[model samples]
Target: MEHANTAQLGRGPVTSSDLRRRQNGRLASIGEPLPIGMRGADAGGREGRSEAPLPLILRRVHPLILLSTVLMCLATGARAQQSSTATYSVTFQGNWTTASTPGGVVGGAHFTTLIGAVHNDQVTFWESGGTATAGVERVAELGSTGTFKSEINANSNAISVIEQSVSGGGTGSATFNVTVTSDHPRVTLLSMIGPSPDWFVGVSGRSLLNTQGNWQSPIQVDLFPYDAGTEDGTEFSLSNPATSPQGVITSIRGTGKFSNVRMARLTFTLQSAIPPPTPPPPPPGGGGFGGGGGAPRTSAPSAPRNLTAVGGDGEVVLTWEPPLRDGGADITDYEYRVDR
Candidate 1:
């Protein structure tokens, strides 16, 4: 349904009379050849058919409508043949030091909570060398995820956005799982490098689709530094007011106080119910179509065992063994939640 223009079509069913009028109007505008068996002396001329008129509904279907229907059918078949889920384990590696030298931008010591999304190509959270949107400006200037979340949530192409805190100064990581269709196969991530003024690191418009038009698995990408251009502060710690004229969102050139630093890493793993294999071809003599495989697998792994929690001076520790049955594939990751 990508690029399908259904905005003009109303939700209610179209009456026979209305459909015919719409079809006639569209055919006149397109001026394309009629479909097979749809052509006749009366097709393009003003003259009417002498014999019984052909089915009105057949002529009413607009070319774009027909194309949309074909695309829908193809999409259905694609869903049956491909995986529809993808999970990404992202790590924030903060290498910037806090100590500012005789003359250098204060090192970006910590990173605020990471916020990101898996969306279609049509939606982009932020762009380089372009004016930063208000949402991006807020995140870069204030280290707040709410604005970014709100902005992307309003976009129709965004499939999912997730937020999790990752302490800076060292490597902190979080995992995000999203259901993805073929039409939406791109991912984006952003996090403010805290104690810095309008500086953040992330990936923009990174695609999950491989060359073969399928979701790529275990895809890895490195993060780059960008200036949001909302604040004029040169050092990590903001002391100055907004610049006279806000700069356009731009890459942090390695030559200046803001260095092009590689700050994080991300890995995306796409998962799906594996389809059954095709049967081998028969000998020269013809044989039956051949029996296909069995039903789809939909079982989940058992939960962890021997879960133990211990409280220390100011921290709680947790440990547990892997699940007894890992369903079918290997247990690649684990998820934990703490309720207030």
Candidate 2:
């Protein structure tokens, strides 16, 4: 006699046992479905039963449902492989004093408002052999960042703009923070040397990522003077004739008044990193054939490890390692309140 739930196909009713046998045979041919009742039985197997009801459950699962589950898992794996974000404290230490460059350091020597952006290889704000844009020209020649700031904001490839300056005489320092991601890891910064024609100091397209695809910290770069090639003046004076046709950007070191000494230096120190967001939990009640509750909830990451602080003349630097347990999700960010 045919069971009430036995499915009919073609000439006769197909019993659950017969369906199971056919499914198992097909799976076993592909190196799946260990003998029934064994651990790690293939997807078609059911444990602790001579002939189980899983065959009915499998029959009820639509092909589309199976495809959706597979796609979700693939997406989750891709999210887990995303890159982390990094924040750095950039310090610009100016050394363009009369003592350092006795050849032509002027009395009112100072640095204009520093302006630049963090971007990728797709766009370049300024480079050694490249011609300066209208924005770069204004920043280098007139110490104005209005045009440059607008230019940076207009570029889709640019990530963030940096604007800071040092006061007092030439030997001052300015510090600011900037964030970077794996996609846009390069930094370009420029600041004009005041009382000059079109001489500026900066780094162009400097990358912070290392060979292992991680942020490198505490990197220091010497800043040299570069001529915007827009003016023909060689001395520290503002009244100079413009280069009639304009020329390509070039280093001013060992040429005329400027010497080979570094005008300033920039230090990039890692502050914190925000890892990619955790893949969303699997949908409620697992998508598998037999519905069950979703996976257990995850907890927040543990506190950062071995945090240490070092005090400087007017600043304090803090560093720490990632938590031992990430709580099954990448850390998004770290927040700390200062008591002082």
Report the lDDT tens digits of candidate 1 across residue range 3-85: 11111222333222232212333332123454422222222222211111122222333334433321110000000133355
Q: Which stretches of candidate 2 lie over 4 Å from their true place?
A: 1-81, 280-340
Tens digits of per-residue lDDT, candidate 2, 106-205, equal 8888998889998887988999999988898888888999999999999999978888877766777899998988878899999998878998999998
Model 1 RMSD vs true structure? 20.2
Instruction: Name the lDDT of candidate 1.
Output: 0.53
Point to the candidate with the largest TM-score.
2
lDDT of 2 at 136: 89
Best by lDDT: 2
Query: How many pairs of residues collide in model 1?
Result: 0
Q: What's each prediction's clash count?
A: 0, 0
How does candidate 2 score on lDDT? 0.64
Write out the backbone clash pairs for model 1: none
